[model samples]
Target: MISTVVWGTGNVGRAAIRAVDAHPALKLTAVLVHNPDKVGRDAGQLCGLTHELGITATDDIDAVLAAGPTAVVYAASGDIRPDEALADITRAISAGAVVVTPALYPLYDQRNAPPEFRDPVLAAVADGGGSLFVSGVDPGWGNDVLPLLISGLGTTIDAIRCQEIFDYSTYDQEDSVRYLVGMGQPMDYQPLMLVETVPTMVWGGQIRLMARALGVQLDEIRETSDRRPLDATVSTRTMGEFAAGTQGAVRFEVQGIVQGEPRIVIEHVTRIHPSCAPDWPAPPGGGDGAHRVVIEGRPRIEVTVEATDEGENRSAGGNATAVGRLVGAIDWLVGAEPGLYDALDIPLRPAVGKLGRKQS
Candidate 1:
């Protein structure tokens, strides 16, 4: 079994722990945390499980690395702390641990990643002969493999649009929703996630990755955004409150122009309240969130993926799926060449063997 450590204890981190424990080919060796209070707690308890996994959470990164796990599932939030997240992942790679994560956005498409972010990861892989795979819902299966696979069924394709439509009130990440995304902030407030060139930096790679997979080159990439304000004061179960006229919903698209038309697109329609943007697209089945793939082509294919955790938490469910995708690849990555790999390089079947072994 491959010894693995799950770093971070956020939504994704918790899901990673569950995934690692459930995988027959993986052994949950350690869980690294940044919060002091979380240290010394059982891994299972940290993830809301009733039983213990016999592994304790630790805040010491050096100590976990010293254990020399074969792999590290870095699930830390890189949105607000990109530098630290990059350093943590690179160090793991340099320590000869195959690192897989959804943290680093730039590394999502390593082929087109900037030198500043790509060079260090490549160097670390070369120095320690370890591999790295970065993927998630957006830069991950949602945009790359899912769309490409659907396109194969089409006799003629006109456009491919990947969308993530969700209500963020159930999502418990306060810092991300309030600060990074400006959920309750005024319309004039600039969110870090949707800032100039940031959307391109985040989802643009996915556009390029998909274009490359489909054997097409984009003429150019473009970004468009629209925001809606709350019609009235509203309260959420997790987040406190949002006053009227504040930013409540956001819709944006990252388009890959081909043949002078926006052929490949990644669109996000996110709202803190369901009533905020009734005109915008909603998730199928009227769920809290979903990842959708729409192909405007001969076959006219449409695919929607909804994730729900044990408690019907859509946000956690989405996070768990992302974690599963990353952890399920550990076995494959262990035997593969040591280098930066994209979703196209890793088959969608990595989760095949682990399917039947899912924990109840």
Candidate 2:
């Protein structure tokens, strides 16, 4: 069994713990957390399971690395403290741990990554003989593997569009929703997330990844964004009040142009409240959220995936799938030579031996 460590105990971290524990070939060894209150908590409690898993959370990073764990799931939030997250990950990699994470946006497409982001991690892998895989749903399997796999069904393909439609009010992240994305804020308040080139910096790699897989040379990448204001003030259960005329929904796309046309597209329909954007595409059955792929081709194929976890939260469901993709890859990375990898290199294998199984 590959001894595994889960770093961070947030939304993504909770799912990572559960995924690692349930996997057949993985051993849950430790969990690292930044909060002192979480330090001695059982893994089960941290991840919402009723019973303890006999593993305690720790803030001692050096001790965790000294244990020489074979793998680690870095589920910490990199949105705010990206450099620190990178430091934590590189430190772990240099200790010879096969690390996988949804953090690190620049490395999502390793080949296209900037030298500054690429060089240090490569040096780390060489120093300690470890491998790294970076991926998530938006710039992750939703675009990389899912679209590429489904595009195969088309006799002739046109544009490949991957979409994430979600209602973020149920999403637990308040500051991110209100401040970063400008939800519930006045239209004049420009969000840092939607600033020029930020969308390109984030989702542009996914466009490149799909283009490479399809063997299409991208002439350039493009970005398009639209925002809508709430018609009336609103109040959410988790977050308090959203004033009338405040920003409520956002739609953006990063498009890959090939031969003067967009060949691959990654679109997001994110709404703070369901009633915010009526015309924008929404989750099927008007549920919380979904990841969808629309392949404009001979078969006109479309696929929608909806996942719910942690008390039927769609956001948690998406996080769990991201964890599934990363955690399921631990055993494979253990056997492969230490290096860097991406969604393109990592095969999306089904749950081979996990069916009808009971968790320990």
Candidate 3:
């Protein structure tokens, strides 16, 4: 079995730990955490997976590296310490561990990232004689993989757009609300909120990734965001955060250009208001919710992915999907060609069937 170590103990990190535990071909060797409260605790318990895997969490990266694991999954916070996480990946790679991460920033959108962070990451992997790859549902697959999948059906394309719409009523408020809908005192406190440089970092790379896969060289890319309030309070008892009414909605649209000409347009919408779903009614299939992807132009494809769980746990569905993908790739990532890679660089086949197979 391929030994693996996971960095971080947050939502994504815990999810990665669970994925590592369940995979037959991979082993959860160690977990790295920065929080003093979390260090030395059972990895499984940290993620609510008590009685599953018995590995403990530690803060020592070098000690974990000395254990001889072949890979490390970097799931640390993308907002606060992205640079530090990148540094950790650099150290792990230097210690001969292949690195895969779900950190938010980085080069998910090459056009939006600072060269200081991006260039060093690439250089570190090359210097360490190891490889690195990063992915997650939104930037990883929703925008990047979905558009690329649709492109496979078209002979010629005019524009490509991918959207993810879901109720944020169940998400962790402190962690996701401000970043997603800009919640504080007034609805407009952070007016033009989602339009900031930070949000752009998440989806920008996906646009570039799709453009490159379609063989389109983008000359320039531009982004815009919109928000509106809700009619009734949306509450998450688990997170203890509520909005008197829908606080606002946020949408990001990136237009891609090729040779001074527009080629593809990618848009992402996150809304706190309920009115946004008037025409496209929310899927009543239950659970947290689902998202629809509608691709226009040659070989048109319309698909909807529904959530399978309910309430605060709705994220479990998407988290499980991401975890399974990460775990399934352990073998290939550890031994394949080294360098930074996105989902587009890897084949979609052979993904773990636990979450359900990808639709054709």
Candidate 1: regions farther than 4 A off: 137-139, 350-360
Worst 10 residues of 1 by lDDT: 351-360
* Candidate with the larger TM-score of 1 and 3: 1
Candidate 1's residue-wise lDDT over 37-104, tens digit each?
Answer: 99899999999787889999999899889878899999888887888989999999998999999988
lDDT of candidate 2 at residue 51, scale 0 to 100: 86
Per-residue lDDT of 139 in model 1: 28
Off by over 4 Å in 3: 109-114, 191-193, 257-263, 272-287, 307-312, 352-360
Per-residue lDDT of model 3, residues 57-78, tens digit only: 8998778888767888877866
Task: Give the runs in model 2 whose Cα sits over 4 Å from its true position.
Answer: none
**Per-residue lDDT of model 2, residues 180-294, tens digit only:** 8999889999988889888888888788888888998999988889999999888887898898899999999888999999889899999988899899999999888999999
lDDT of 1 at 78: 87
For model 1, name the residue pairs that clash.
none
Q: Per-model C-alpha lDDT, please?
A: 0.89, 0.90, 0.65
lDDT of 3: 0.65
